[model samples]
Target: MIRAADIQDGRLRGDEPRRIDPRVHEANRRSRLETGDVVVVLVGRVGEAALVEAEFHHWNASRTVAVIRTREPDEAAWLNLWLGSPAVRAWCERQATASTLQRTLSVTALRKLPVPIPPAGLRAHLLRAMRLLEEKAATNARITECAMQLSDAHFAREASDGTPWPERPLASLVHITAGTAPRPRPDHDGAMSEPGTAFVAPADILQSTSPHLYATERRLPRGKEGRVCAPGSLLVASREDGVRAVMNHVPAAIGRNVLALEPESVSDAHWLLHELRSRSAEMAATAQGSAGRELSRKAFAATAVSWPPQEVREQFARLAGRLRERARIAENESERLRELRGRLLDGFLSGTFPKGPLPDDQGVQPEGGLALSGPQGIS
Candidate 1:
């Protein structure tokens, strides 16, 4: 089974290949993936999906996956982003069938889902904006990778030196806390949650490969839930033994199965987050429980972390901080661009975008050989 975790890194990352029976591969000719197809999970985690690249066209998809073939390349790009949007995800949740085992979506239902397809002229503007925003995000990802490499190199150098750094139990420097237990689910027609105050879950923290949060789905009225996590506190997943950590950019009501690390002494929160990433193996080893792997407060507080001299730790933090700050700026810029793109898309698809047809001479040609012109002239 190709579970959601396989591509939870925000893309299909594995390079391993598997053999398939020719008979099984040919059985679903109609659904066979082609280059640039967008594959979505049809069963558990229905909205979890990714844009398939040319290299994966030869590979077959499991039945849990659904393939979306767009009429135009631009449309495929639009669909990929749209499918990941909060609006679309909410719709999927409402339509999904839930059982004791898991939730699943049907192809027929997905096909019938309404989408506001824009006219050619406005679509061209949308595609232009989409390309620019996506490029910016890709740039930030590259920068983040570089920052991670630098951090790893520093740790490697420290490890090479003789005499390990003095270690201290995590409780000595930081307080370990878990989130408020989730209340019972509201009746289908009743509202159990509200927006504005973010209610963060394990999956939300895991979405970012870095030690920071970019997005989430759960939210509540301000202060509705206990264990309110302020910006800069580190968070780790406790549900199903998910082993990832991140720092919040805003105050959020912590959800069940999430642990928050609050700095109480000299240990810097940012440095602590990176250190936690380095000791993930030890954290995983302390995972407790059976039905769902739970890391108890006792286990969390007992985690031993290296404590280097204050001056050395501060120096390292200063160097690493510069790289992280630069990457953070790029990430923030890209996030803002994505939000703007979503708004523009919503307007264009709804026929509310301030534009009508433009003169032939004023038309702008997109890279795809299509010209898009309007009252706004593709602004």
Candidate 2:
């Protein structure tokens, strides 16, 4: 079943979705997904949506997901893109009813969402551009995944080779510093690029696919620079799901829920990242609670970890660093593509881009010749 947690970074994570029996699937026929259906999260991370591609067809969604079917198949992509806009996202946040634990978006709010349609030609142009950029980003993600897998393989081989790596307390090899709580600021919401240090939060770490992070959901004010961790520091967070870690590529202020692990040497940082990732489940056991899990500093610090000699670690670091750098480059390129996408969408919606013929690559004529109709509302 596709739960709210399955909707991640504007895409559906089908890796480990819960499955239901055939009887259950047939009973809840309305939840069955058809190709081109858009599933939006109605609980946590409200409004996050993903298009139901051919592979996911016939899959049943969980109660937390709202299935949105466009009148026309082609409209599905356009509607999905519209739902990702800042205005729509903010609207979802405002409309969501907050409970003691989390916020929920009712079907009434989802049905009332305003979807502004651009001119026919402009809409066609925007869809083509969005597809091209999204495709590239997807390709980059694959490249990064492969690179990370290769690095993992290398670590496995090195750790298992003849010599026995000593079991040492985590605190002995690295300094574990807790993050500072963020001060209230009503001005900023959503991802911000304002002048300040990138604030690393649990969401940022959880959503990332790459081992390195260059930006985050929020930023810290200037004078708060002292709270920022060095560029190579590994940021860690724990939840009921598991433990996740990402090395910061830039100096970043760590949120209260995050823990910053700084190794004395750069080479050690590389080894530490993979070590922690490999032990995610093991480390998660040390977390304090079942709900809203928090890693126990005392437990975590006291935990024993594999500690290889300096020479062996440095050797592995050199090889792993090369692979990671390739992934980093792809991630950087993807970031640029995303920025360009936002600009293109903004320009087309604002009528900044003339309703003229676009470059061949950017323009894919829509199947229907009809001009885009009035504002659309979801059901």
Best by TM-score: 2
lDDT of 1 by residue, 1-379 (tens): 1234345423554433434677766664655667777777666567666777776775666666676777777777667766777677667777777764346777666775665555555666667777777777788878887887787678656545675788899889787887774532433622236555776766666545667675565557555565677777888874443467887778877766678888853237756877777766667766676734465767788988777777666777777778778878877877787688778767655656547753422332322311111101000
Error of 1 at 176 (Å): 1.7
Clashing pairs in 1: none
CA displacement after TM-score superposition, residue 180 of candidate 1 (Å): 3.7
Kindly report the root-mean-square deviation of model 1 from the true structure over all alpha carbons: 7.9
TM-scores of all models?
A: 0.74, 0.82
Misplaced by over 4 Å in model 1 are 5-33, 41-49, 58-65, 70-75, 81-90, 97-106, 116-125, 183-196, 238-242, 265-267, 289-292, 350-379
> Model 2 lDDT vs. the true structure?
0.76
For residue 67, model 1's alpha carbon misses the true position, in angstroms, by 2.6
Q: Per-residue lDDT for 170-270 in model 2, tens only?
A: 89988898877573242434333468887776767876777788776567778865667889999998877678888898988776668889998888999
Alpha carbon lDDT of each predicted model: 0.64, 0.76
